[model samples]
Target chain A: MNLLSIVLYPLISSLLIRMWGGKNPKLAGWLGCVSIVLSFVVTVKVGLHFFINSSLEPISHNLLTWAILPSHAILFSLKMDVLSFVMSLLITGVGLLIHIYSLGYMKKKEYGRYFSYLNLFIALMLLLVLSDQLLMMFIGWEGVGFCSFLLIGFHFESHKNMNAAKKAFVVNRIGDLGIFLAMMIILAVLVQEKQLWSLAFEDIRTHLDLFLTKSIFGMSLATVLCLLLFIGVCGKSAQLPLYIWLPDAMAGPTPVSALIHAASMVTAGIYLMCRLSFLFDVSHFASEVVMWVGIITALFGSTVAIFQRDIKKVLAFSTVSQLGYMTLACGVGAYAVAMFHVVVHGAFKALLFLCAGAVIKASQGNQDVYQMGGLYKDLPWTHAMFWVGALSLSGFFPFAGFFSKDLILSHVHEHHLFVFVLAMIGVLLTSFYIFRLLYLVFYSGKKRDLPGYITPWVMKAPMIVLAFLAIALGFLWTPSFLGSIDLFPQWMSSLYMIPFSTHSLWFEIGLSLLALLFSAVGLIAARKLFVHGPIADQWIKEKFPKLYQLLLHQYYIEEFYYKTFVHDGPPSNRKLSQDTAFTNSLFHFISVIKGMFDRYVIDGLVHWFAWIPQFLGSIYARIQDGQIQTYIRWITMASLIVLFYWFLWVSGMIA
Target chain B: MNQLFCLESYLVISSFLFVIGLIIVLTKNNAIQIIIGIELIFNAAALNFVAFSYFRPHVTEGMQLSGQIFAIFVIVIAAADACAALAIILSLFRVFKTTRIQNINRLRG
Candidate 1:
């Protein structure tokens, strides 16, 4: 609620761990759980105050000022608006659930260090969402990335986890580059007009005309900059081309996958998109590009999720696909819809991953679908919770996923019909993969025999809470938030988007019906093949070999990255030797070529003119008269003339 | 005293000393001499600053601010720099002694 909580959370969490200092890690886990719970409660109170009085009272706390130069002051502060309120609420609310879930999921393990990383993650996610300025947000951004790197390699004893952590960090750096570039562009625009950096949100937006309305290189610079930045979003949000890291991110603990991959870290890009919506307004063409890219990635991601063998990987790819939907929502001039999807998806998707964690831990880390069958018999709570999450994810009616996902498709339909069709295809893929995952793992006719490991009531509590939120939050949308506000129509007047009476009629009758049909078909099809059919897995792997292989292998994009950037790259010194003899060899080569051109072509003409004078100077230097004889002769002649002049009128002549 | 003051000679002597210092910094194998050469450059700059300060007193903080600041900064930088160089030299001495840059080749593979 106050500034102290923000700073106090990590401190107390650490101190609590130290107080419970032990090699045995249960105490540390409890300390982490208590700290996050306290932090979440404070954040919730703060969020409620801000949410209720959003327009008039902008909630902000100047936590501390870290530095102040002559020209600028770096104020580390928390600022909450409608956007931050939503993000902070979800982060704390859902983040607390994940932390609680971690207690049970990591019960037996040494999670002291792990909990510290997780606590730091919670703290950083709060900073990221609550901060008013870009730099502070980036610190959170980089902070979360660092924590993710730590958590993903939580099993640091394993080399695979370490490698995957490196991969995640490196891939995230690509997006971080975009963030850095966007900041640079903002700075450059400011520099042109003698404006200060003034990274405060409103200050930057007020100077929007200085950057966005300009043109460069035969195109609007703003559009170019926005498009460049979306590349960053693509990386962070696990969009195509840079999504390879996310699937591998499953190397961490299940709660890490749930927190970072499903809910928090992946949502960062969408959060950034919503924050910088002003830039998107100027970049019309960039928005269209974002729309198409989102559509394609959504479809591709769902397609890949269908073939994933590992349970967490399926959920990981599902997060990717679901994030694509949010990106698509943002792309098509629907901010509220995108935020809705982010909230809804964060709940259900995080639930799905955590439930998957329960199942995995119960199955003793057995993640393969073929290995895990009929879990429903032994693990009823986890099974039912998993189904609720799966159905919500599949856009079943009355689920939060249904309300949010429909808007994305609806906006795509209104604005870009082709993207709409692609999104529809994406929805079909989403249904297929989700139901398939559910059917093979849980609902298969054959029961998965497992040890009678009854999860404590604490484990089921978060699952039930998240499941309720996932389903019931759809009704919370409730047509009331849509009442006073108008959703501006695509390329049309706001009058077109005013809350008309038929809005609910269409959602209830048409959209809801389509959703029902999709769920029924997906459920029946998955059940028919996976539940009854004996050779379902084999049929998929053998019959659809090429597509299955491509999906399973993630389209060989990792190989493509290796061939392009890694193998032939300026080999990293960590991977190779750090040669002190060589540095920026490529730059040196370019400089040498530039030097040759400058000498022989550019300066050659100047030297051509200089050659004659240079030759003359060389000859004059050789003929220097060092002797005094010639000097003496010249002086005597001058003296004789002076003497003659002196005879006439020496003083007068001198004057 | 006025007749004896040859500004050109002082300028020439300073120029010669500055060039020798530059050569030492660029080409010397001994780290200590390089540090001394850097000190020479500092003195050259200080001499120029003091000369200008003496010639023009009423100028608005131009030579006053920058001259005094540079003089202080140069001394502080020299001290800090000597400590750093000494650390590097000590470390290098542990690896390869003789205080010569050329022999600091353990860094090479």
Candidate 2:
């Protein structure tokens, strides 16, 4: 199997399914699954090749030359190094499970188009991970973003879904601008200093020393580039300021929420950072910014997730918060740990989202945890899967999230104590909210009577597979204190030159125990408050009504953003209208002035420019009356004038 | 040459024909009358060419009959133009139930 086939298989199948699979939706879904399976098999073969050879050389193949320039050529190349291999393995594996789950979740009528989009997403995501060049990776980045938008707005019949998709897209573009600018600066600096214009990862690595010697705007060039690229990461990974879109992005189908938003596409940011860990390692200032933004986002996402009642919204925010953890790991110069979390997070989060999809399906599309209770009786398989996912996400011992989260916390502790404390609080919040969701959805209140709703085996199969992964995948990267094989970092050591962790075994064990304790506290608190019904929730709400409301409204950040950037006027203007009589009159006076300026200055200028064309057109309109006689009469008079001029010129009388 | 066939006489007669054709085209409402006026202008131009070629004083060898050949070509072209213009007028009449050019002003911008 060729390396190109890993990306090409899904792309070709997506087009084929879109064109010919319309008549038989089942066939379309099966075809999509088959293509992804083929791609996954090829990826495994590549992995096996690396294992057998034990060679540090990456498996790279140049598909085609995209462009030829004076200095260099841009090649559309695929490389399966340690980093790309791990990421693509996660993408295709999780992606395959999601595609299968979608067959059971999506409506029959939309199967062909839905699977086509899913397949396209897989193809683009694979491209994103496997590309050898930064330019090709950007193509995959934008392509996946496009696919995310398409899938997010799949239910285009609803205006809300469409709006959410647009929100996700526009926010992502803001981040994409950073990557674009970084690429430009890289090219420019390379051209100016070394007369080299290649954007391949290997080429950039070889020329890293050249960038350190250069400066941009009085700061190190590497720092600016890393920061700019982090902007893209923040957008893609849904970090603090740009995270509003991920929650809204749950407006898409549940399977899409599982695949694109939660599992694969959102992790592209972390993957890119890991891919360029060399540059990030050199820039301490950029790493500091990344670390701060990441920890703050972790806190912000988990805190807001606690008050969310929608099942998918909670998971969406959890995904955001978990993404923040991965970024945090990256920020603290733990690229392997970040990647390890990405892998383990991919397994558990995708499992949770798929379980959520099953629950939503069994409940006949109801997503509110407030309305759903005691679902463990009706959806036994989904309930079991959700337990696995929740435990893993909560960083319980023997679960996938425990190892990765512990590793990240240890890394943060080594860097800054303040951030470490905040990260621990984030960890507590993560466990609390996820268990809160689990308790509210499955254990609290009376058992829901879901008539004729059965969790299909097709869906159950993927969940079971993912549940096992969530339970066991953490073993890939056990800490040194555990005295186990740390295969993940060892596998990735070629890509990341930094040592995994240098702390003594006792310190590592202590931090792990501390992380485990925080998670336990969060679990006990959630069990006390939510597992027994609404009594404790009522007390909390009654006692701290303002704080409850604040959390429920997500700190009013979305509203503040809307008012400041999207609203037509200041939010204060609306408040002032209902104030005292003097303020009301003052508001009216201000409005009058504003109205006058708008009408006379802005509209008047537009109208004046518009009138110029209208005035000229009206004058010209009279000349084209379509009357042959009038046209001929004008022609005759013009010809007479021309004849007279010719006569004078011929006689030399006009000289 | 005879006085009736002289260049000056021919030029005067052609100018009169041109003026009459232009007036007919500018004033007439009937579409067929416009076609007839255009044919008259073509014939006036052809007549001027034949007259100038016949009355020239220093005609170059092998080019003496160039003006007469152009006159013949113009007459042939005028015949074809009359056919096409009449066909268009016929269709216009069928669509509007009238041959008046003013009523066929649908081409107005």
The top-ranked prediction according to DockQ is 2
Alpha carbon lDDT at B46, candidate 2? 93
lDDT of 2 by residue, A249-358 (tens): 99999989988998889999999999999999999999999999999889988998998889999999899899999999999999999999999999999999999998
Screening candidate 1 with a backbone cut-off below 3 angstroms (N, C-alpha, C), the clashing residue pairs are none
lDDT of 1 at A327: 85
TM-score of 1: 0.71
lDDT (10s digit) by residue, model 1, range A137-176:
8888999999999889988998888988999999999988
Off by over 4 Å in 1: A1-4, A15-24, A51-56, A65-68, A479-508, A568-655, B1-109
Winner by TM-score: 2
TM-score of candidate 2 against the unseen true structure: 0.82
lDDT of the structure predicted as candidate 1:
0.75
Candidate 2: pairs in clash: none
